[model samples]
Target chain A: MNPIAQYPFEISVEKVLKSSMVADPLTLLDCSPLTDGAAAIILAREDIAKKYTDTPVYLTGSGQASDTLALHDRSSLTGVLAAKIASEKAYKMAGVTAKDIPVAEVHDCFSIAELMAIEDIGFVSKGEGGKFVQDGQTKIGGKVAVNTSGGLKACGHPVGATGIKQAAEIVIQLRGDAGKRQVDGAEIGLTHNVGGSGATCVVNIFRR
Target chain B: MHKTSVPGVWRRFKNRYQIVGTQCETCKTNFYPPRELCPKCRRGGKISEKKFAGLGKIVTYTRVHAAPAGYEKQVPYAVAIVQLEEGPMLTTQIVDYNTDELKIGQSVRATFRKMYEDGDEGIIHYGTKFTPIRES
Candidate 1:
């Protein structure tokens, strides 16, 4: 058996399937697909950045935090505290609150992840994430746009490359390069990447 | 082997059949899949082996349609993390239940099973697994 698989931690499924043992009423198929890929982003100062493209965005705030690797020590399994810390730093750097983030590309390795990101990034209150999605607050044109690239659920998780991929996607959206997944007139954005059951998380805020 | 060491050795082997873990005396923290030290407290205090009932809650899992090189044949299998009642979580094959029946927070019990057999007639690897506790 893989040694890491045997690590002490909590596990939960965020998506439902037609077949399963009701083990948390979630299924494996609903989880994000682990993948292998690479992504990159180019950053430049505002004054000299105009040459690269007509619009240049700023990476305002960024933070990364770690939590108990074992899920048993966590106060709540459904959400991650590390993400909240990272988001706070990013939000503050952007000179905005959750309300200013018109669209976001979050880590949705599982369907429930998008919901959790909503709360972790301060977009909504804890436990209210599920409702936010159900209410269409995270849809393309609603209050915010989330995971338009199909997220980890549909896209893929290449581990070391997932974080960079998110940054690339945000840049595309800010530059209106996301083809069909682009958000209309997105001025500010956020990205959240988590590692190993929320033990590690990074939040980055950007402005166009 | 010396008689004085026999009892301790036997006890150690017996722990393999069950999910045995270690707890740091100073930190009061337990480790799953067993470890030598406390990751949280960072203090390498007294460590003691402890047996844990495999009963746990299902956190999240995945049905691997495509596995790594060695596990290619066992496609469409279930892998999940079960949060033990005492503390710590374990990842193991979930079997004897429909894949659709998986749910978050569902209770399960450990069982011994063939993890994978080697070669055509080589050694059969045994490992721990979990299944839904059938409610009467």
Candidate 2:
């Protein structure tokens, strides 16, 4: 999508359910669309960052991990092993736990993936993500605001730009520039980016 | 025409004809699609060809209602992850079962069948597929 997108229609659960089925467990609504978009961030050292802006969001921690290429080689289908490993590394570096995060942007390449990623990244105990979402815990005012940008589902996934787009969402949330979608008074935020069905995963934490 | 090299298919005839994989003697590990060396044991383990009897149970499955590219005619086919008796799992299409009837832990056995036709006049590719093992 372009820098500013104007959605012409409304999205609801009923419309999604009525959408065409691409696969038995996954529907056309569940999959992200291939969008034409691009995102860029200017990184600066502390001294240079201070020269540029007074409200520079700090990149506190980052972690990356990989899993077996073959899905059959994986131990479980319900969780992403790489996401857990990567997020743990990031949390350890940031000196914070999942409870400290008030806002997050996770890879929602598919709806089921969002459920699995929240569990893998330790946002909620394993198997609780489904229930957590069902109770409206991921909304803007809910327990921990997730995917405030409507995630990849509605925001559009431009493959390579998806990761940076996620980070940009967190940056906006942490800097209090996200407008109505902002998680109120969010000081720390996190973004999770995945590649090719959990073969690769990356997590980054930001603070302002 | 979706072209698949004859050499590529020819090389994997063993795996396509039957469930032939590799096993490491040191750690008693099995691999499907085979491996050049043991991932865990590496140079320390003895590797050999292992022929499996193809009996297994379904771990998970999906019916693909949307086929990609040249496979548009094969929509709504059943695909599943089957855990073989030898411990390794394989991703294969499930045959001879209703798409809605596929279930987790359902007993299954491998069967050889035509995988795809390259094009209208292209060669027919054959490979192993799993089917539900019906009880008498």
Candidate 3:
């Protein structure tokens, strides 16, 4: 399937191409579209979870962290520190590490964001994210299946709804309801969301 | 079309116009958007005003095709994270040169420019932007 056709909104391919920097080479295809949408999920206590559904997807752990609002204030530009910190906390609370996650829905507002996220979450060594993806480690049936739901790159990014959308994708994967994009025997899944550059990050772990 | 109060503009005038930042007298760390208290020193740090040299090199950059509401006219502009000589990074637009000239580690110098103009009756916003310094 043509990836561009999968986008719900029309992408301004020309504008993206024209804006490309000589050194960085970012075409419009490398960026996520501005979308208008929303997503919501129901939360239930463990006791009442079964009342809602028999195969209740449990939220094992969640973590959130913040940094300076402006991108310039951050100490490092290569990775989102907040993401690294938040994911570490989430992994600790879930009693699992990055290596244990079989599937993940990560923020890909920009293609670079997804690359940096994998590294920040410790799925790959720092500065090796680009090479890791190129090596097919992030592909389904590879080391880790990432963005099986098309991610923000193919999926639309409604600013306020992005975080919830990421969680919903992970839940669908955990429930084995993500037909065609399901990761076989996926017992653990993770979702990562970031706000404005590297200012805020939230990481959640879910288990079936 | 955006409405910015006089005081809001006034508060940021120094930093926006002159690149005035803050330094932690205790830890010797410099901050770009002048902070009242240093994060490293917390309540124990003594903060002092420091004027930046307004010169730096580009660390990373992006060509923004989609801009926020007010910056629509400036679409396809180049914005970069420049590491200032004083050891603080700042986000500013790269102007007065072709986008092809931009590269990581290229030297740049800050220049004051009009960021945006409000509605006809609104005040014009001015801030610092960067330009590549040509080598002899």
Candidate 4:
């Protein structure tokens, strides 16, 4: 079956079929598709960036970390420790905290993954992420706009392209180029990308 | 199909069959899919082989309907993060139960099973999978 045609949010007869194809509690809708795509952005020093674009999005800080290749080797299954470490380093280097960022592009390969990313990156306290999302805190114009690009969940995760895609989304938001989905007055944004289960993670902070 | 050589299979026999892992002497940390060095202690920590009891519980799980390249036959299978009794956690398939029957914190124990056959000419790989521990 062409899974892309069966996105749960879209109205289609295939949606019902796709929903039933997976075991209960998690359907195909919860997972990201293996898509083919690419994304790229030219980054430069502040002086060079200012010369290139009037509204240059500054790459304030970047951090990366790795854990065990296998998911089970990690201490906590609920959150990605690598993500936590990476984001913390990014935040420190950027001289900002999660609350300081009003918008973010998070890795949401699976629905559950988004929840874990929010918590792991310190947007919400551990175990409170589900509630935070449920309360509409992650929606555009909420406490923090997350996945303004529709995320990997709807944006289509092209493995190698995911990190670049995330960065592009954040840069677009910080540059005030995102059309209707743009978060109002978004000055600072963050992008998170994970490889494999949670083995590798990269976090980048961008500011207008 | 994925290919596995005789030596590759032989090297992991102790871990796949007996669940042997490693423990760091300096920090007393344990590892599954055993590592040669302690990430925390690096070169300073001494490592020693340790055998696990093969008993643990599910920390979290997902019913993977989308099978990867060579695992199409195992579609809709339950995979979980199992925390072993000693300390280390490992990702392994949970067998002999339906999705509804599994839950976080449910007790489980390792059982030998066929992971997959590489190909017609390749080795039939074996590994430990977890199953719900039946209450007596």
Per-residue C-alpha lDDT of model 3 across residues A1-208, encoded as one tens digit per residue: 1132247444565766676542346656777767887788788998898887888888998999998888777767789999999999999999999999999989988878999999999999999999999999998889999988778877778889888888888788888887767889999999999997779999999999
RMSD of each: 8.5, 3.4, 4.7, 4.9
Q: By the DockQ metric, which is better: model 2 or model 4?
A: 2
Kept native contacts, as fractions per model, are 0.05, 0.95, 0.33, 0.52
TM-score of each: 0.69, 0.94, 0.85, 0.83
lDDT of each: 0.76, 0.88, 0.86, 0.85
Candidate 1, which CAPRI tier?
incorrect
Residue-wise C-alpha lDDT for candidate 4, range A1-208, written one tens digit per residue: 1133213254343663467445445677677877887889997888987787788888888999999777666677789999999999999999999999899999998888999999999999999999999899999879999987778867788889889989998888787778777788999999999997889999999988
Candidate 2 CAPRI classification by DockQ: high
The CAPRI quality class of candidate 3 comes to acceptable
lDDT per residue for candidate 1 within A1-208, as digits (tens), equals 1111211232333324553422243455556656767777777778778887787778988888889787656767678899988888777767789998887878887667778888988889988988888898887888998876667766667778888877877887888877666799998888899997899899998887
**Candidate 1 lDDT, B72-113, residue by residue in tens:** 677667777788987888777788877556777778899987
Model 4: CA > 4 A from native: A1-24, B1-12, B24-30, B40-46, B98-101
Please give the ranking of all candidate structures by TM-score, highest first, separated by commas: 2, 3, 4, 1
**Tens digits of per-residue lDDT for model 2 on B17-125?**
7899989989999988887699899889899999998999999999899898766788878888999999889999999996445999999999989888888888887
**Candidate 1 chain A weakest lDDT stretch, 10 residues:** A1-10
- Measured with C-alpha atoms, the lDDT of residue A105 in candidate 2 is 89
Tens digit per residue, CA lDDT, model 2, A1-208? 2235323245788878888888887889889887898888778998999999999989998999999877888988989999999999999999999999999989999999999999999989999999999999998888888888878877878899989988888888888888767688999999999997999999999999
